[model samples]
Target chain A: MSELIKNFTRELPDWKPRVRPVNLDEATEAQLDALKVTPSNTKVSDYVLTLAHDVESLKIRSPLFNAIMYDKGGLKRSERELGAIGASVLNRCIYCNAVHMNRHAQLEKDTSVTDSILADGENAKLSSRDQAIFNFSLKLSSCPPKVGKEDLIGLEEAGLNIEEILDLILSTALFGWANRLMHILGDPVKLENNDS
Target chain B: MDALDTTTLRAAGLKGSLSAAAALQQRANILHLTQKAEAAVLRPKDFGAYNHELRHALAGRICNLNGDQITADQYSGNAGTYADLIDPGNDGGNYDLEQLVNFIDKVATRPSDVTEEDIKTLQKAGVQDPDIVRLSELNSFMAYQIRLIAGLRLFKEYES
Candidate 1:
């Protein structure tokens, strides 16, 4: 029995790091240039680089990349980060949740609101549109198959056009895949460690 | 175009090809939000199974043509594979939604020293109506099963 168990364990692949965090100074100038356009500082810059590299290493590109780079239907930086945070929260990715929550705070200068949203998504004091967006993101992150006409109707009620909804779905799906990859590969590193 | 149609036509004209792209983007966003709403209702521990179910449902292709009388094996090959979407896992699986629901109900209904924060955490982890109404209540799960039967639906529509 022990031998069978050992064989089963051995058949499982060894763990490997999909992404390693890199320092800002160590990143290429091209990377720094990319960060500059997105209104990032050293800390945000390093995090983005690490996240990008990790994503690339995983053989995945976050839908967030498009939201950031192409401005896909003008998805703001805050909203994009909110989507990431929502996914991390759903996936129970402590590392991602902490990282995204902190980044949102830095950018928005309102930790309390972010904290509230993380706490109670539906009743958070966000604008109707933001609440709808967050609500939609939460549902997508947690239970995708359940999505239906009513949900779409709610988005329409929230005044989001079809294009905006598509962008949100892409972002949510990208993060959903990402959260799974991160969870299976390894728990996120601590937020303190994530920074350096 | 009539007066109202003129405004509509003008907006359409201005939107041009962007409308198609925008439509695709909007669909993607709705998918994302739906996932998030489901996640908000789940507990942290339940997330794994929830993830599995979401993927299974999204990927499922089976349908129940005559109602609940059908058994899994009775259906012609792969006919009801998609049925797994609504059914919870077998005897011993960590990702069972029923188990998660039971657990959440216990916590939500019980009296304990649990703080508001703790309750909130549990709430955040649970899967609620906005997250799953379509699948469980509106029979979107059946629709998904039908799509699988027809092979005409865009699977990526669920992917986001």
Candidate 2:
């Protein structure tokens, strides 16, 4: 009976696989070349290469990438990832959410905590600073102009410096733009079949 | 950077081009209007009417607003009441002066104190002058969007 209920509640028509302009293999090459670096010597296929390239291209173009990778003057990598994940979740980008969630899990083994954050939001277990970041990201994602002075003050109170705060805002803004692009373009392809 | 170099950069990315910057700035302004529109949260019918009125008001073009004239090719697939006409992807109209000033004042000044009447006052006081109108609209929209985004952050802050 439980099985029947579960099956009954399942989506009537499983989502048909979305067709993409670039094939997995060709996209891999484009992604790798855009990043301007070769993939790891491990037996990486075109898909992996493409994924790396996409990240690399984003690194050069996106303020969000700089915030996550280089701008750790005040916030830790985990905190940055948390904010990013929050934004991705708010934007409803399953690809970005999944990618950042996996990264968070890689940093911390407790997947349930990350899952909870994904389920709820920045209100999930995190420092006040991280909470501030998550809140900021969500606002930026949903209604950008609604972000006001009080929000900046909150981050300042949370101990983020002016530069870090600026980075956070820019990162959030960049992701908002990127999320729109991703939403319009297509679903994010899985880098590996085994990836959760 | 040299003119040639600047041109090259502009070609490479949307952020790099003068036109692209203008587009982004315009988008930021529209986002602000959309926020205000959403806060008011008009019924679908009213929202659609208001969107139609606003587009005609801004563009000076009597568009059908019900997607009558819009073709599939022009569809930008943006999610908004005015998505058909004002979709960032659509190259319909440039920034208007009056709208630009309102957007700017909203950002630099406290919007809470400013009334719609004040906006009208500003508009009447030569806010829509051709000189600096285009640039002002672009700059104001970008600034306003940023500030609005900042304000939204505050809203979320209190929630936290």
Candidate 3:
């Protein structure tokens, strides 16, 4: 009954990921290993399991996702989620936008910040620092070919250190990968509203 | 130690450590594997072949069409022209290949447009179900690399 689950399940899809998602029970060793080490350390996400169809690739992909989204060296978790929200928004991937927005709210223990981003993106009402990072992510996702120096300067001016900036760049880039994969591999489905 | 020159790294907006970073290097290697995967797809498992370059060319052309200049500029030059690449004569540039590439583009730019029919087309074209899985995963990988490279290049100027 949580809002995140409700919203996620409510979203319908015209396509199912792949012709048929990988069956978790029947998956091989590498696929199961990939699932075991994910940050959640549980096979909770149907989206990821769907990706298990290509088990070998998932072995590398799962860890990479964990490394970027979790602590490797820099950026707070909430801020990284901000970068995810940025890319998902630009890609117009509502599923990703919703999930990351919910994660941000959970981590920060503040719903308003997530609300602003889900509502307005880079234009969301936020501190200069938050807005700059969001802008960088949006630009990175939508038109990476055109990302410029001023955008980095803006991040620096907003008080982000080298590591934080690099972290955002990495996270934003990861989401560009993650969001597209999620959109392609599977759709979110809620059990309660199965017929809705 | 420098596997890639500074400009190559910076132009892609990636750091020299791209080759050094385990996660990234793994992806770079994964990208290389697609060449092999497509190569296998193009030829019989172990027989004499008509085209050593045809499959490579088709995938190369897909990179350009999808605007993944990062992949194109690095691996294959932008040599596959639209007319020749699509092979106006070969079933709309080989219906099977065309269908796969078209699906790849839509996956990168607009996922909603992708339907089961896209995969079904490849199935009908003789692509094994397992290979189809690999093909779609590879498509997303290419999209990720392009976006990441573009983002890095965009941010490179300011990083210093």
Top model number, DockQ: 3
Cα TM-score per model: 0.42, 0.44, 0.70
Q: Distance from true position, residue B20, model 2, in Å? A: 26
* Residues A119-183, model 1: lDDT tens digits: 56445677777777777666655432235556666876988765556555555545554444333
Alpha carbon lDDT of each predicted model: 0.40, 0.40, 0.58
Tell me the tens digit of each residue's lDDT in model 3 across A176-195.
66766666555443334457
Query: What TM-score quantifies how close candidate 2 is to the native fold?
Result: 0.44
Ten-residue segment with the worst summed lDDT in candidate 3 chain A? A2-11
Candidate with maximal TM-score: 3
What order do candidates take by TM-score, descending? 3, 2, 1
Candidate 1 residue lDDT tens string, B1-160: 1221221112122223343434534434333433332232221123322443343332221222212122222223232343443332321133444433333222212212212343234346564422222122112222212211121112233233
Model 2 C-alpha lDDT per residue in residues A116-151, reported as the tens digit of each score:
675565467666776788877776555323455577
TM-score of chain B of each: 0.23, 0.23, 0.54
lDDT for residue B54 in candidate 1, whole number 0-100: 43
Supply DockQ values for each candidate.
0.04, 0.06, 0.29
lDDT (C-alpha) at residue B21 in model 1: 39
Best by lDDT: 3
Off by over 4 Å in 3: A1-18, A24-45, A121-123, A191-196, B1-70, B77-92, B112-132
**What's model 2's lDDT at A158?**
91
Model 2 scores a C-alpha lDDT of 0.40
